[model samples]
Target: MAVKLRPAGILLAAAGALAIAMPVLLLLPGGGGAVPRAAPVPAPIGAGTMPVLARVYERPLFGASEPVEAPADAPRLVGIVGRLNIDAVALVKASDGTTRTLAIGESVDGWSLASLAIDAAFFTRGAERVRVPLPIEPGGSEAGTEETGR
Candidate 1:
């Protein structure tokens, strides 16, 4: 009987050849040289404690201050130029002696035009209120500006 070489036999021969050649290749010049070298090492710090840590400082974003006060002489309402519905355009004589036409929500002398009535307009600053009235006219709808007690 004749023994035939199969693919399996050829692979086995190649593996054996590589196994035997590997150690011999390692012993050659570039592989495992005459003298072996050591691995790297880190340098030592000088004789002292670890370095001191730094400190950080911060400040407030929105700082608080004293509250603002209203002017000593606030605005005064003198008369109403015209009136329609519940809103009226007021002629205000300010503390500075200047006459100004003010509508509701307008600010003068640190006071705001809070509201309006048929015969008068009201100015306010915090808890303070000033009422200015329209002059009485002959044969008018209302007799005069009523004194609204607050």
Candidate 2:
């Protein structure tokens, strides 16, 4: 039976031969002498000492920091749909007189809708938060609610 050498086998055999021959060739005279190592660097006199750094206080990027009521020009919450917080969306009337439907994490007029409830939408900008509740109609019901006469 004859054994045939495949292309992969031939390449692997060549690699093995090169690996075996490399060390022998390097050991031969003037065949790239042993590589010289770098000298150790000495530490400076005060290298072990750490300098005293001033304490830095960073302001919080989120959460209410004495949040005031929404400004008169701020967007108004017109209505809210969906009961679950995750799926709820708020309809807002922006200062530009355009009505926008916003979901949690959605932004309108630079304020992001951080969360939503059945009757209100909470928006945040930087550390300031504003809660906009659905306006109540003259019938004493929320704007989006129907009067059942009960």
The top-ranked prediction according to TM-score is: 2
Tens-digit lDDT string for candidate 2 (58-118): 4345755664577775679988877765577888998899999988888888889888876
lDDT of 1: 0.70
Question: How well does each candidate superpose onto the true structure, as a TM-score?
Answer: 0.36, 0.48
Give per-residue lDDT, candidate 2, residue 85. 50
C-alpha lDDT values of all predictions: 0.70, 0.80
Q: For model 2, what is the error of residue 45's alpha carbon versus the real structure, in angstroms, after optimal superposition?
A: 60
In model 1, which residue pairs have backbone atoms overlapping below 3 Å?
Answer: none
**Which regions in candidate 1 have their CA more than 4 angstroms from the true location?**
1-72, 134-150
* Runs of candidate 2 exceeding 4 Å displacement: 1-68, 143-150
Q: How big is the positional error of residue 94 in model 1, measured in Å on the Cα after superposition?
A: 1.0
State the local distance difference test value for candidate 2: 0.80
The C-alpha RMSD of each candidate to the native structure, in angstroms, is: 21.6, 12.5
